[model samples]
Target: MNYIQGQTALDEEEKEGLLISTITTRAELDEFEQLNIESAIEWTLHKKLKKEQLLSESFVKKLHQKMYGNIWKWAGKFRKSEKNIGVNYYLISTTLKILLEDCLFWIDNKVYEPEVIAIRLKHRLVSIHCFPNGNGRHSRLMADLNRIDPLIAFAQS
Candidate 1:
């Protein structure tokens, strides 16, 4: 496992392609991660989202994959092991499905202000910690992308 600044730890299960020697320092890792995230942001900016896309498990996975696939081998995949945070690994899919449904209802019913919904979604997604790494960033990106319109409508544009 690569130590970030000899303090914080990156996941030990990072892809084999990531060598401690290749990125000896946290600063280097930060730079690489930033570059990857920038590219993902660019992609989101250019691509038009559809309503169906927001409700998709595949879309969430793909977005995470796009954001971190280059940095981690397990980018698009869920964690197999339990972490100190998040629901059980097995519950990820089910919990996410429920969240999506709730989000749909929120949009359909105008249940909350758009900003509140976005913040709520972001907070809940971070809590889920769906990915081995980059969950917070991934969730934040998802929330930002979701702000394009009225909840579900955001995905439409």
Candidate 2:
């Protein structure tokens, strides 16, 4: 795969997950993923989601699935192998749960301003790197969703 500067190259195993076999370059892959992501964003905008639903592990996984399901077989699933960054592969579920709980607590107690909460949640989600790819884009979309609903800045992650 031809990765643009700053774009992370997918490992061979991860690349095999791609649904579109014709895409052999980063730009082509990016364009396809971007189109899929746009559809997912539209889906989120049209749906009626409760706050509790938004903050759950299922929602996070579902959002990822929506964002990349069209392009990757492993889109919504948490990675099963070790990577260069993020919590251990075995600890992804537990770590993400803890992060969500902490965000909930912060919101309940007004522990931080909404913007701070959003940024922290976004940063942490990216750090967690739950999926094999698109963590950064996922984190940003989550933060953007939070901007739409002010109750808590931690939105669909």
Candidate 3:
């Protein structure tokens, strides 16, 4: 099966699978790379930080760097300058917010099934392309956690 992880605007087939994948897919995460998975975690932490939820930014940065430890030393840190992807231009944190606010809407909402929220967050995070890399996997983690985590999903949002 060919699956696109972080695609915000889905083709017809993707939308059908959206709710299904949010539940079953997160259970078996072997298809995703470790880096992608870790970045997803970092993105969630980033989202929380953006909300002023009181998590340490430095720790989240360490986690992000640990995700891509060998390849990029500056993994967790936000880029100092602006970035461009195709025609779209964005600052690092703005991209992060897209994942947090827009993509993670299910998590943002006051009440919803974790299963439901996961799909929404997953879909939206995939859509945001927040980081230069690992966005799909980041979407996955954000979705997965928000789906299961009532506290973070509710308190932070």
Candidate 4:
């Protein structure tokens, strides 16, 4: 579980279920994961999304699965044990439900500008750290899928 200088370390729970054992170095794992995530992004880019669809728990789980399924067997599944980050393992579902409801409310009421909404959603999701790995990337992709233009401008700023 030793992390490369700047890379995040995979905990026992995170790496225990990996499908690809040949990946020994952090760079190799990162490269494979990035490729998998890029493919998921391309797949998501073509889909037409509805507000309800965007707010569903299923959508989030499926998105995570799509982003990391090639690299890990536990992709899309919530962590079963505590990690160095994230909510307690048991709270992930309820916490995510609350976050999604809040997001739905934000969208429904237009409580924030689109850029703000996307940024907040991305930040909250990453804070939740629902998955064993790739929460940051998954959340970023989720934000991008919501409103790419706004997120793009928001990021550049």
> What ranges in model 3 sit over 4 Å off?
1-63, 77-87, 102-111, 152-157
Every candidate's lDDT: 0.75, 0.83, 0.46, 0.80
Model 1 per-residue lDDT at 24:
65
Over the stretch 1-157, how does candidate 3's per-residue lDDT look in tens digits? 2345533332343224222234345324333336455564566554544333322235334545555444433355443332333114344445555444543453356456657656875665455444444455545654565555556556445
Ranking of candidates on lDDT, top first: 2, 4, 1, 3
The TM-score values for the models, in the order shown, are 0.85, 0.90, 0.46, 0.88
Candidate 4 TM-score, C-alpha based: 0.88
In candidate 1, position 110 carries an lDDT of 76
The true-versus-predicted C-alpha distance at residue 89 of model 3, in Å, is 3.7
Over all chains combined, what TM-score does candidate 3 have? 0.46
Q: 2 or 4, which is superior by lDDT?
A: 2
| Candidate 4 lDDT by residue in tens digits, 1-157 | 4574544456776677878989887789889999999899888877766767867889999999999999899898887777677789899999999998887777667677677878998999888888877888899988877666433334344
Query: Could you arrange the candidates by TM-score from highest to lowest?
Result: 2, 4, 1, 3
Pairing residues by index, what is the TM-score of model 1? 0.85
Candidates 1 and 3, the one with greater lDDT: 1
Write down the lDDT that model 2 would get.
0.83
On residues 18-117, what C-alpha lDDT tens digit does candidate 2 reach at each position? 8998998778988999999999999998876765677789989999999999999999999887777888889999999998888777777778777787
